[model samples]
Target: MALFVETGLKPLSANESYLGKKTKSKAYRMYENHLLRVLPDLPLEPKGKMKLTAEVYYSNKLSDLDNALKPFIDCLQKRYLFNDNRIYKLEVEKFIVEKGAETILFRLDPYSQEGDKDYVPHPTDDREHRCPECGHSF
Candidate 1:
């Protein structure tokens, strides 16, 4: 699925980058609210690993990809789009949009572990138990 938001809001600064900045500016607060409002309702517990991709179309070429994506991706965590740790892969791309039109497109998909030999389920899985003592498998 995809969610779209208007472009041009700046991202939050990385931790402690600017020393002694005691307060969040109004613009930052507004940006946070806007992201929350635009984010779609995501599953509280994803079925499996997830892949998130964002396509940022900006009128200005100077916008940094990581800076543009941080606020939105972080909001996904707050809104339960899936934990950042569960993400198997992440993709972000930027494109120059027409002078007057710029927008951000967010897409997400669940990835199943079926057929994957390296898959190791979480401890909470209750599907079945194997008999280690006997030569039996469940």
Candidate 2:
């Protein structure tokens, strides 16, 4: 099943939160509030494997991608969209729109794995090729 949500509220950037002050948590709280007001109640089922797609119509082109993504994921977790750990895949894009409402549109899709062969090795592949010239293990 796929779920979609869209909001016109502008998101706080991680850069804005971390630039020079201790306002990260406070900004996140405000962002969360705005999202809660616009978002619908999430479904009760906890998704096991899902891909998240986010399109950010940014009010400012200076906003960092990762910064914009943080509070959104936090808000989703707060509203019980799904466990953060359950998100196996993520896709995010940012667009600059002059004289347009800033917004975030997202979709959650249940991902279907092809097979074990498609799974990437998680550092356990044992291909020791780090620092080959120096033969350093660090």
- Give the C-alpha miss distance for residue 30 in model 2, angstroms: 1.5
- Per-model TM-score, in order, reads 0.57, 0.64
Per-residue lDDT of model 1, residues 49-77, tens digit only = 77787898888899787777766776677
Candidate 1 lDDT for residue 20: 70
Candidate 1 wrongly placed segments (more than 4 Å): 1-23, 43-47, 112-138
Where does the lowest 10-residue lDDT sum fall in candidate 1? 1-10
lDDT of 1 at 54: 85
Which pairs of residues collide in candidate 2?
none
Best by lDDT: 2
Candidate 2, 11-116: lDDT as tens digits? 6655565646655577677888988788887554464677778998987989888777767887887776567667777788999887578888998776655553
